[model samples]
Target chain A: MKRLMAIFERDVTLAFRTGGGALNSVAFFALTVVIFALAIGPDRARLSESAAPILWTAATLAAMLSFDRILQADFEDGSLDALIESGDLLSLVALAKASAHWVSTLLPLILATPVLGLLLGLPAHAYFPLMASMVIGTPALSLFGALASALALSLRRASMLITILTAPLLTPAIIFGVAAANAGARGDALFGPALMLLAAMTLFGVLVTPAATAAAIRFNTD
Target chain B: MDERPADAGRLIAARDIAAQRGGRLVLSGVTLAIGPGDLFILRGPNGAGKTTLLRTLAGLSQRAAGALKRSDNASVFLGHADGVKAALTARESLSFWRMIYSAPPAIIERAISRLNIFPFLDQRGASLSAGQRRRLALCRIVISRRPVWLLDEPTSGMDAVSIRAVVDLIAEHCRDDGAAVVATHEPLDFGPGRTIMLDEAA
Candidate 1:
């Protein structure tokens, strides 16, 4: 627990103190939404109708942009190797690093999503569902992103490889997230089931991805 | 020297080990019997797999074929990278590592002062010199107080005074029943340690 907290705290501190991690992604997210609005032109009905997919895609992309940096920084600086050798638990440290990434990047994006939604001319009703879906769904997004971050270690240009390798895997979350947000926009109860599925995906990623990442890190650190 | 009785101390042993990196064999038929207070120096030409051997012995890398044995739980491995975050101050970085190793604050304070880093304890990692960064990394190994210290080129960037300080620290660590495996080309003052020579794999 002590070691895990150490890993977690250090990552969060670095993310905020450094200019490039969370805020960079948030800035990218808001800019993308603005560009998206200007490009599509401001037709409220058209924008609200398309808000769910646009928002989901933006969120996923923002999350992806932060993926390659999370574990790779530690790997590059030799901290990952030290952590892997520290004690008996590699998975715990992996989970901590992933959690830190989630908190630093995805959590901020989720907070900014609703405000960005207003920019898309999304109706107030869609707000709750969008945030709800992201709250549950983004865990899986961040988890999968961390997994990709680990796999990217083996590649020469990890950032280049991250999107191509992880985008397909992220499709289910995007599909379900858009579905949930749209249903909630229509005041339908189907959003509940969609939310549940999203939560399940998060849980599955939570349970499985850490060990895989730890193994990949150990293998790649050498 | 295998002259002493084998059962006299703590042991971490690797036998008939082979290792490959990037699908190419880098080291093979390597064996080592490391125990407490052993300051083993690894000497070799560049690309001779000295780092690979230290990493393998530190349990950070897999050995392709090896029977390994160990009775110690505390081992510290220091590779080329210092693992300092440019955004974090020296104090924050050391505290974070202390939290990880569960080492006390006094140990960290002592290690910092020992390395003459009190002046820059609040300096960001990026602002510190390479030798200072190396000192912070050494401070971590000292704070870890692990029985086995595996350092690769630990004193590469330090001035003579700093190098002498590090050498003294290693000697002090070994005096306390700790063991160290150092890979370096510089002549060090560590006393009467067994030396290993690694050759580039065929």
Candidate 2:
């Protein structure tokens, strides 16, 4: 518990204290969604139809933007070397880092999703479902983002690689997330099943992300 | 955990340990032993593989050639990067490390005063000078209370006073039955420590 809190507290403090990356995530998320809406020429019907998937995609990319923040700083600054010296500590740090990333980056976007929802012509019916699906799915984003951070720690440029690799992996979460929100807005009966799968994906991430990320970090330590 | 007793009655041995970095063999044919109350200095030229040896000893990297053995307790690695985040205050950073190391709170106070970091404990890492950052990084040793310290160029970018303080801290840590392997080009005033000099890299 102390170890987890140590990582969590410091990350949160830095996230708010610097006031850059966290805000940038929300801004990037909002901008991407808005631009998509505008680029489609402000047709409310088409905009509403695409809004849920676009928001989900924007959030995923924004989460990736800050993926390097999870372990890159530790790797570059040699903190990860110290933390990973202990066999057990690396896994704990991985879990703590993923939790911190969600709290710092995704929480803000979830809070701001309603406004972005309105701007993108999301129907009133979709607001809660959008928020609910994001709440369920965004943690997976942070978890996989940590995994990507570890995979890319030893490389010079990794974002593009991360996108190519994780896009196929994240497809299911994105599909279920968008399906839930779109169905909720359009009063389709698949909403409950979609949301259930979204939540299950987040739970699955909670179980596996730590070990995967820790192994990646350990590999990079060499 | 392993339930092994702490650093007491423990020894770390390296026999013909070879290390590589960036796909090139840097150091080879090394042997040493570190026990409680030991102060071991790694003296070599810039490319003599001092850092690589330290990393191998710390278990941060695998040895390419021979075997390395140490106590069940892990050694702490302090590298050139200070590990101080620019957004955090000195005190906050120390507290964070304290929590990570599972150290007592008293160590934080002692380290802060011993290093004379109280003047800027509340200041952000970005606002500190290079020497100050180095000093803060050295404090992690005091905070960790770990049995073994693998320090790579620990005193770089520090003034005379700061260097002296670090030397004293290491000496004090040794007196407390702790061991240290410090990798550096410059010699420090740590008393009675054996020096392992490395020749050209292989």
TM-score leader: 1
lDDT of 2 at B166: 87
Q: For candidate 1, lDDT tens digit of each residue in B67-181? A: 6666656578999999887898989988887887788789987898778778889999989899999999888898887899999999988999999999988888887888899
Task: Compute the DockQ of candidate 1.
Answer: 0.74
Q: Residues A95-148, candidate 2, lDDT per residue (tens digit)?
A: 988899899999998898889888878888889888889999889988888888
The sequence of per-residue lDDT tens digits that candidate 2 reaches over residues B1-202 is: 1223443355677777899987799988888767888898989888888888888988878888987777665578888899888888898889888887788889998999878898899998999998899889888877877788889888899899888988888888889988899988776879889898888786
Candidate 1, B-chain TM = 0.92
RMSD of 1: 2.5
Q: List the residue pairs that clash in candidate 2.
A: none
lDDT (C-alpha) at residue B127 in model 1: 96
Q: What stretches of model 2 exceed 4 Å from their correct place?
A: B1-8
For residues A1-222, write the lDDT of model 1, one tens digit per residue. 878888888888889886647899899888887878887886888887888788788888888888987788878878777788777488788888889998988889888888888888888888999899988998888788888889879676577689887899899999999899888889889988999999999999999998988877876776
